[model samples]
Target chain A: MTRVETQDRRQQAPRRSLTRRLWRAAPPGLRQPLGLVAALVAAAWLVICLIGPVIAPHDPLAQELPRFTPPGEIAFLGTDELGRDLLSRILAGARVTIGLSLLLVCLSMLIGSVLGLLAGFFGRWVDETIMRFTDLVLAFPTVILAMVTAAALGASLFNAVLAALVVSWPPYARVVRSIVLGLRGNDFVFSGRLLGFSAARSIRVDILPNTLGPTLVLASLDIGTAALLLSGLSFLGLGAKPPTPEWGSMVSAAVSHFDKWWLGVFPGLAILTVVMSFNFIGDALRDALDPGVERR
Target chain B: MSGRAPVIAARDLEVTYPGHPPVHAVRGVSFELFRGEVVGLVGESGCGKSTIAKVLTGLVRPAAGEVEYHGRPVRPLGVGRRPLAQTGIQMVFQDPGSSLNPRRPVGAQIQDGLDLAAKRARRSGRRSGAGPVGEPPADPANVRRVIGQPADAAVSPTAARLLPAGSPGRWLERVGLEAADQSRYPRSFSGGQRQRIATARALAAEPDVLIGDEPISALDASTQAKVAYLMSRLALSQGAVLLFISHDLSVVRLIADRLLVMWAGRIVESGPTEAVWSNPGHPYTKVLLGAIPAPDGAGRLPLVPPSAAAFDAPPVIHAP
Candidate 1:
């Protein structure tokens, strides 16, 4: 038996290794190109968040002569009501918008995934209590919940992030819990038990890994929603305070000066682009990770 | 095999699911599994065959009665913080597709048993106050000792036994799987292939008792025969007791040396397979055997409904 297995492994050594299997699953032709472009745009958005502060043309908080300036070569993209460079403000806002949203999403995913695993794997009253709480959170309108949370927390960048985290985690918990529920009865999990693995080991090895693909796909999609919620709170004066130049706050500052197209348009466009980029990546990732969709 | 002490013995094992009206799944079931023999448990669906299997494997704790291993009562399901000891009992589930995790490669899945064996060996080694037993413990040679295979290599007397590398491939091969196919995920394989992979994984643990809960019920007839033959052969070669559970009496007759017939949560009749086939003592057993379709289209034995008194009577525990 040992000799035969060794011979088989040697013969199949040339086959693609396990890590490569994920990439090989990417659909060929149009979807592949689209997925690549979406991935690159998302990557670019991440890079902008990381380096945007350094690359802003002028101090984003600086009050200057030309306030509400329109699109042109000088002060290109234009200036806001405070006379801060619109281009510089939008670039700097990436740091707050993308950074806060990512942080919010990661925190939520962590909390949700762990809770979900616990509820699903342990079932009984644990499942009921966690899921009922999740349902209570999910029952509310997400933005309203964030707004209420932000209002109660006293409206700062930190408070807005906290609000988003609170509002966003329930979906993750719900999704992960459902996935875990389905997986609990699976043979792999039972196999883990039969092998004398501790419950913790079985969950870590057999259950948690299976939950990741769906949870990740949901998280990526939620990134766009989280960004929208963060921006909305900032627009409502509950996010980053003035001079911080958050995209939503920029649009709010420009709302009264609606005629000044660049002020609102550029910032609005920034939010749109970032949100769309995440949506695209999320869609592509959903396809990429789907077990049913065979890769070429 | 019959005269020796049973490796695993269940005395009046009962399992019930709590609900508005509790489900009485198994009642007063008793059985013994001797090493180097195959014992077949046959019953109609929902007659508690699978539940009994679960009780034995520690997946489901029996609500009543005890399962003793080597004469010591152990938790049916040894979850969290249990002492590290090879129960030498593994199960092959009915559905391979659902049994294997979709995200993992079959090879990785197969390797899990080996990894677990190594962990058990290490834990047990530490418990015995033996300094590290083998060279690095994870080495395949040391792993062989972990899985109960005799190791040729001389190592520190305190070194713990662990499952050797390439054992997964060997076990897969024993179950008629190609060694190279381990890299594929469970979703990529057909039903038969997946079953084979599942069997390999169960065998890889080198269990002293292997239980099949209708392991081949989902396979085609030809595939069923091949797998059944493979399982019995592997179990005998490894000196592991096999508990073959199925509704198909013909298949049970093919592999099992001892036959246990269960009906409505009770073991109705049991004896040597040939003896039971020649003369079924219980009415339910006769109905079951008569139900097997003959090639000549012969009529089945008249169905004998159990008397109401029979249903009301307390379960008759079978003493092996």
Candidate 2:
């Protein structure tokens, strides 16, 4: 084969996602392995979510009709306060929790990434002004910070998402800003400008694509945290109301029947299973994407 | 050189980055880079030289006219997306250390690209290392014989089926490094040493063309000569096309067989290195030749503003 063809053959061998293709193309020094893996894990989580609802065994919300029963027949994790199947409720709840968490994270990343790109690319007094504003928000204790937002907006799934996003986006914005600071001065970015990537497209293509390697991992890890925060809000009666089958609200209802321990145990277990698995996936992804990072 | 195919042939190219009415960085640049022959691109800071470098490599899109590789409109001036011809071309960036992920180890970093290429041949069922993008090492004995090494020895690849052609250690020494330095990160090495490592890494891939965008620009003056010497050594040793880009005229003069000059996205002058240096015709060409500071600083002069006539005059075109 001609040398280029040989090389082409070699490169053609590896089928990859857009992220992997982009990462592989970067010089060895620029590859941040842990960050890539984390992002991949997040993407995998989304994939898992896509096929999950169909495979869930029993209806996640099918009531057992026998109240306070422990792991037994007709119900996997036993019954809740209304004699509902715990496993059923937990399985069904994964759809909304995973779906909404993704939505909130996506919206947050979009808003934060764009703002960061604007702040970073324009740099000047504009950068300073936006940076200070993010800092002001950052100064607030995050949980308490999200609380005030939830209160002002009034509690609901969508509103909680908005509140969480307001709290979450600053970190993404900060990360993207720093990255843009480095990228904004690069030859490629300058080349993009010269090539007519335009100020916006340059940031969108040259800058934004690079930022995702890190930002996405953070967003993935943040999903589990965001879910927890939303759950915690619900536990405090700031989330979805009864019969909504929300994990946090179910946990909240379990409080009234403390003597019936299965109610609290099952919901808490559901939260733990989803959160822990996501955390593991995040860690694995960080490892895989950053094959370069020296594993600790 | 003229008979050989011109992989990259450009005529009167211009580049303007968007800004206040757009800053015209490179104007009327033109040249032909032959297949298997290295063309040296040189100019001072903000002269639109680097812009031209990116234009050819497909990393930077050009704003006007044609940048053809093998008669294919690889990256037409103002092409919206990267084209196939451009995709075949790859770039070895300025800072090798910074170009890599800070947190990753060097082995995997190298392995990452190798792995990606290997994965592509999944249907071919070729194992990762000894495929088309890479070659089996030449016999270890050959490397030892070339460098007269006593420091180390290993199994020769002369009879091997899949490894690259030579011993990795001797190759390191060939690139002006000790075998021990192979295991060390680029950070532990000096600026010159790091550059040498980058050159070695680029050499490892055995690419069709190597575009060194000021590969030695980041090194100190004292170290530049050796690094330059090592690059020439590797290029001759491997016979890969070397397109050395630098702003240092003195440096470009030492290594280039053919010299291509770019000013504000246009080629003001180009010819055999000796020809362009001795008999520069274009005004910009004369400016560049005269711009070179003479020994004892006698020939040194400040940049004179280009007269309005120089600005308005159509760019000079030098087609092969």
Candidate 3:
């Protein structure tokens, strides 16, 4: 009987490994085509942000082209009124526009989720203090609050990011807090407490892992919004002062010469593509993380 | 059971949930559990069986009562800071599906009990002379041992019989679970298998008082008997006091050494299992026993008639 069981196990082993190997070797794109395309687009922007200066065909700041050149001029996407290449300027702007938005979103998410977890888990006074502060911050429109803070701190990119960070965190705190409150009364958490786990230990070991998927989906969704808000800040002259290649400031510069058209359209298209890609990635992430939702 | 102090004793327990009309969940209920015996507390829904379990485990504080472990009163001391004595009273909740954390591997959940046990042993200085804390003791039983074995070691000959393969497999195999499946999540297993995992976790603590609040009712008819038998047998072998709470009298009778029947937040009857089964003293006990359908298909069991008002009222308290 033992020999027969061993023979049966040996027969099953190779078949399992072969299927797993085949699955692993298949490209991720083949399984979820839309997600793959979105990921590729997002990855291309990140690569461009890193190597923008090296790959630009012309010096972004150097005035070497005819003034207000339209598309198909010596400059690929034509030139700004000051005659700088629009393609090169857009390329260099990707770093400040995309990079700063990602950094601010990450910072806000970290701050918000921690406060939320503590408030939901500890309750009573801890809940009261954190939630009241969150409520106060959330009372104002986020843009108005961010604009005021950025203006107060002087119209610069750093201050704009800091301003956005201040307003962005309250939503995350609210989301994480609600999730933790729901799980607080779950049986597994009670079981953890029965086994002599401290509140901190229970939050870390039992509750935190369950909350991660939802929080990640929320974070992905927020990336596009963060970029838009930062661009809005720059457009208002509260971020990315001139001489710095920022897409929002570049578009703002185009507004004076509305007839020039190419100046506004190209930079607008760059923002659109990046934002759309992130939104798609967020949709894919939500589908992947939520077990209740069917994958399309 | 005589001449030895009870492992756990409850005195005049009362629980009331405040509202427009206060709900008195458990009123003037008391019981004592001796080590190495399965004492079944049988009742229908909302008869305070779960409340009693909660009061004993210190999840809910009783309005007026004290829970004594080995004759000394132990109060609830918040989470993670539970007194070493109170840590020995572990509970297995009814819904096996929710009792185990869905995200965690079953092995880590089992290991939680083991790690806490080791920590308790270290703090109490019980292992000072045993050897290094990490080293396995020379006696294989000690390596797998729970705290404070009952005076009669020979009482659980069935402990050896239950797990013949030896101690290395630990608590998982003893409860009829695969030790190899320890790393898998709770969603991977069926309801019966999850119940087995829950039982394994409760027993891994080597608890002195193991409370099963409707532990097997959620399982299918076939798996119910197997899980119930496994739970009682394993708890008894560890020299633990098994408080098997269930609505199903049939499953309870098969494993319990003694029986306590509850009605309207009070126990109406108490005695040895066979005595209560054969000649129940209380009308409520009689009604409960009669409610169990006999498989011979002789006749349908009578439902509780409106005329049976005596069965709904609380019976006179009897000290056991």
Candidate 4:
């Protein structure tokens, strides 16, 4: 059982380790403007999420003395209508917004991957039942589905996560199902099946490896979608509620005091920045993982 | 005949997967199998040679037909389910790397069959007392988890196949491989070497029938010959039936004992290798036989003309 285990362990490394190495050793072709932009944006998002609360000058929720205090020594991103430091609030909420979106993405992938493995690997009744169920869930727009689920689960971050997980898992399941459907009857799969691999086991073990390139691409793309959903939910006052320093909730709170442009501008920029970072990362990952795939 | 049952006998075999406008992959492909007989299935790509292999190996279900083992009909198996009857029939695929689980360790994948055989032997071996059917106590799921089984329920019958109880090193040796090479991934080894590993795996299963679906097609010309020789030799020594499917007429000409020539999913000719090679009665076989390049000193052999115009287009590159 231990044969070549050490070698395999070394081969199967952390993605972050790989990305870090890429950053450290930027290849000659990779040292371009766009690559630099994408890498920095992705790395910055990770750093911001990791160290957001520690370095900010003021409490994100603490109000400043004056509203609309344009970029000054005291405040970096100016002041909101409530006189809160825009920079501080943006910094503070990075953890909650990015963290929750990522969590939702992981949860969705877990559910979708398992469901996809079952549906694809076992394509009779199990395939039909899972596909029909996913389609039923996909019948509604993600926002609408999240809205319904959140309303039922009650308005909270956890509930918003539930909504996102429920709404987003189907796309992954559908993609994986399609990949499985294509590869299940292939010669290699037949060999695996003949070697005594059961349907579920063959999908997970044999089929999933070859299919993970697309699955990873789908999961990466879903991170941005999940973030947008999180922000939208918060903007509607269903996520994180208020005063907990969420970008979406801040935008929602900013709406009440329409006179102040800084409130809307700062939170809006924060949401855009985080979402754009993930979108850029997804594109970069797709290219790095499959150089053969032309990004039209 | 040593009074032993035939390794496999598929009668009136048919395979049809409903596609857009419906496609008939294999239609009424019937053949009898015997222990230690190497039956060569020759046809062009998409001619359903692989499909017949899938059907015989229990990887694909026949829409209509009777598949029998030892003169008895066997049930169909699917993705998540495999019948006990099929555990003894193993397959070696063309793409060696893909057949192996990339996420798993190499030894574990080979051990998968060994473990399964061991477990099954435990159940049946106790009653029959076949001197411990496998070397050691092995579990299929334990092997499967290493091959990326679901997080829950580590090993299940649906997860992986188990090899026998102990010492896979010997199995490696039997396949003409050294013990040092057992731990390497399929990617790490050359194509010929991987095929050897695949052969070792099939041997570990101790299958009644070894199905080779173009197992040598993916290898280099020289390597293909070596692997083919190894497979036939090992198959004979193990006393297992070798069902070799290939599109390479020359390869089959060298390796097969009995030949079954197929086209458009149905067999056109079936008989002894020498009979089919020297006197191919079927027009299709005759055309194919004429196409094979001859040895030096032989005069310029003329190309065979196609019987039908449609057949000329997308011509068979290598017809067995």
Candidate 5:
């Protein structure tokens, strides 16, 4: 058979097999209810974030009503201190907050995984150099590092994401490096070398696949932390400047008007919902991905 | 058999693991492997039998000396750009479970070897200006000579094209696995089946020299016999030189043409398998042979003392 046919056959086989395995491995009883609820909530949140701007009734920034208006017919969640729709602002903010967090997580995972694979595969000097650098980055608390990076780069939505990416990648690298260190000595890797695979090819084929599951679990868990950090940075005036309608920025705007519960409550709930959903999903993924865990 | 050129030859190979004291794994070990010949390297655990196999297959680099393929010194661990020499050596590891990537299907793992073989074929074909057919290329340069004319003047282009379409399935079948079983992951298979898959993978490379580092040690007696029989048959069919490393004398005796008895990192005895079985020379070889329990439940065999003299002195008996 030609290469294309072989690839086609393999592709066809895996899709069916994967679905079957996943169906068979689905969580049962209380775990199932917990996992299903978490998955649904996370999925719902992502959908809302994706379509929030399209469906929002009022212009998030429009000052159409009197400032600090209570929930009524025109605006379901009431108006903010600026007389802007709290509901619309929260809806608009979802896109920026969630999207930036996702991007940061992906970028960090990519950078971290590659460096870790290299360090783990080629031990001794290569391992030491990369790990020492990772240790340096990890020495500082994550938020402090993000704060310093944001401060250095100048605060904005993009700069906050960049800072988070810079600060978060070291953990992924450390996790992947440890995983690779354990797997490099496996007989499959040795066989790969004996089969004339180059070091890079062996790492890509043998090491990378094994590292992905754990890294994915890490990525999911970190997304919540990243979202929280990004929101915290914006609350501190280091991210998504005024009139941008970011969740954290909205909460920051509501702080002085302590009696205007609508301004803080809705946006706070949005952040809480998103972060909790991610944590749930991450927990489920950790259990699912572990081979030692009994799926049934 | 006597006149046949050795496919691979090691000269005074030494491998040491760097540490506080440094492990002297294999010391001054030398052996020659010929086409279609199965040479068993047997010793008790930690005697460096596996290390010798690793050295021969280029998995472990020797601290001193070199491994020559067709009279040329190839890199000990497939580290260099010499694709021709690299493709010629392949190894099956001892642990079947760990020898396969858990995430990948067994078939895909087998295809890795096939892919390497195909690449090697394409490269050699392009270099020789012959389209991977007819007689093998005659250029001494193409033979990857280290210092002299290669005993085998040409590498068989057939070796490269050995894995055609559906060849992994064919190899799996040859190793007593189902064709459809290739689609399954390594974790899905039993230890014996996984070993068979690993064997299939090694055979798929169509290597000139195939090394089995305690390949059957992990299997039960029945599976061991079956896999050993399959390996010997496959090696003969492919005309590949087989380096069967094991501490199990019975298994080696069943498969090997010649035997190299290792004792504390040195080959203490070397001879035809039957001859050595009949009249073992070297104290270590005698001890190894005596250690094999008699099948008829007879009285205990006499215990041979570990020879300290062999450690300090050169081998006293060299078999012809």
Candidate 6:
């Protein structure tokens, strides 16, 4: 039956074809102008987070300008009551606020998704143990539980993240568990088992890929909420310590200087833009990953 | 007949699913499949056809009786161990579209069978601490190197097509597809082509018994015959016992050498395909035969009156 079949002669694609394919398959919501703009803004913030301190105009901690200087050549966004450059402080805070949020989301999603896959696939006692724990965590109001955990862990950025992570992962477990429950019944998964694949192999190779879209959509939507919660903890002084340039602490510090409106307004605007941009991106992801959308 | 032990034997099998009231899915079903024979298991909906397929492949443990492969009792699947029956008996599922992993290329999906076979060989080789007589040599220390060996040089010719690096493309060709098509995803293939890929994957493992449970049910009428023909032909050519299960009698009649008719979780009639078609001994079989719509319009459609007696009657066994 051997023929001199010429080996696959299909022209090699450009090296970045994988990237192109991902771009093509991206949800229509992400491709739309609103989603694109939101993505651009989010990308800009992420860049600022990575290299914020270096690019910031002045020493964020330096009270060099005179107190309460209005927007001028000397102080662009104006100086806070402490005479620190508001632009420099907001720029420096972006790293702690956004980076911590992304970290919390990733950690929670990883822990929760793995637990959900195990609970859904193994189901009997495993399901009971995981779901009951998830319920216990979910029963508490999210911010309150995070606040209590943060307070208990002491005042610091790292402990705040740990508290947020503890509260945030339950929703992921619930969502991923339901998705896995539906997918575990698919014939491909059963066929994998029939083909002598181990339970772990079947779950990873056959079932995991199917759950990615929904899980990803959920993760994207949670980024902004994660940021807000972390900021909230910091605002309560149970998070970042004084002079750390965290947005929530900056806003809290401004309360003492109520007459200086710019003290409150700049950091507030920073939080709003970051949160709104993430929300827009999350909405687009949900639309893109919707089953009714043409993924091909 | 070969006068040898049956490849797969199910003796008085019963499967009861637990629910509010227990559903006796398969009640005292028995059958034997011989090498190189195509057996058609025909039945109406809800007659426990799929349940029997599951039982035979050891997916669902029968509450009573046993499934024996080559006279050895097939063990129930235990945690962390490969299913004993899986190495010898592979199944082609109902829906071709869903039977394949949509995210993977057809080539990698086919490669799974070959890789599994290599893994099984390595396991046995290690247990025996040497290559058993007439078995493939213990896989090279590097499995990838063994897979890269030429198909004919890798193992026995019977298993050559299952070499992970060597024969995915060849197996695709055996199922009437281009070797180049292996890289394509399941969605790109038509229903018939996907079923053929399913057949190729199952056959690649060099199983002794192949169970196709309504393998063409999701396909169009035109594609159904082609896929059904391809399956029986390829399975026979490989000398595997092909237990072809389906509800449509016409397709079964075209390929099956022997026929087993099932009703309400029991095999009601058994005989050669032609013998059962010509002279159905059971009333239920007659009703089933009559229900097939005659496209030429020569005979009127037969109406089946509700009869408890027909369902409960003893099975009619016919000599081959």
Show where candidate 5 strays beyond 4 Å.
Answer: A1-30, A70-74, B78-82, B126-166, B294-320
Better of 1 and 2 by DockQ: 1
Interface RMSD of each: 2.1, 7.2, 1.6, 2.4, 2.0, 1.7
DockQ of candidate 6 against the true complex: 0.51
* Candidate numbers, best DockQ first, in rank order: 3, 6, 1, 5, 4, 2
- Looking at model 3, residue B195 earns an lDDT score of 83
lDDT of 2 by residue, B76-155 (tens): 43324433224334445566445433333333334333333343335346443342222222332211121322222221
lDDT agreement with native, every candidate: 0.77, 0.63, 0.80, 0.72, 0.79, 0.82
True contacts kept of 1: 0.69
lDDT of 5 by residue, A177-230 (tens): 999999988999888877877788888888899999999989988888888999
Per-residue lDDT over A1-296 for candidate 2, one digit per residue giving the tens place of the 0 to 100 score? 58989898678767767877776765443355544454455455465467644655555555646777777776668777677777767766666677777787788788888889889988888789999999999999888878788888888877777888878888888988998899766644543333233466666656776787778767766778877887877787666656767788888898998887878887787677666656655555555456377522
The number of the candidate with the highest TM-score is: 6
Task: Put down candidate 1 lDDT per residue, B1-320, tens digits, no spaces.
Answer: 46689999999988998897998999898878887678889988999999998888777889999888788775755436334464467889998568787778888877876666556556656321122211132323211121221232111233223433335654455565655667778877978778777877777666678899999899887677566656766566566788989999887787787888899998888888877888777767777887888878666664666666656544332333
Q: Kindly report the docking quality category of candidate 4.
A: acceptable
Worst 10 residues of 4 chain B by lDDT: B140-149
lDDT score, candidate 4, position B247: 87
- Candidate 1 lDDT, A57-121, residue by residue in tens: 88888887476667786687877777778888888888889888889999999999999999988
lDDT string for model 3 (B133-229, tens) is 1122233421122223322221223333333222223456656555567778998898888887887777666577899989889889877877777
Residue B185 error, candidate 4, Å: 4.0
Q: Write the per-residue lDDT of candidate 6 for residues A1-296, one digit (tens) a residue.
A: 23333232223334547867667667788777789889989999999998999999999999898988987888888898778898999999999999999999999999999989988888889999999999999999999999999989998999999999999999888888998898777777776776788888888888888888888888888998988898899999988897889998888888998987888888888888898889999899888768677754
- Please count the clashing residue pairs in each candidate, in the order shown: 12, 48, 0, 16, 2, 0
Model 3 agreement with the true structure over A1-296: per-residue lDDT tens digits = 49999899778867677756554454443246676677778899999999998899888889998989888948889899888999999999999899998998899889999999999998889999999999999999999999999999999999999999999999889999999998887777877887888888898898888888888778877888898999999999999998789999999999999999999999999888888888878887776666775433
Cα lDDT, model 4, residue A81:
67
Each model's Cα RMSD: 8.1, 14.1, 6.3, 9.9, 8.4, 7.8
Residue ranges of candidate 2 with Cα displaced over 4 Å? A1-166, A177-181, A184-296, B75-88, B95-97, B112-174, B178-183, B294-320
Lowest summed lDDT across 10 adjacent residues in model 5 chain A is found at A21-30
TM-scores for all candidates: the values are: 0.82, 0.52, 0.86, 0.79, 0.86, 0.88
Better-scoring candidate (lDDT), 1 or 4: 1
- Cα deviation at B180, candidate 2, in Å, is 4.7
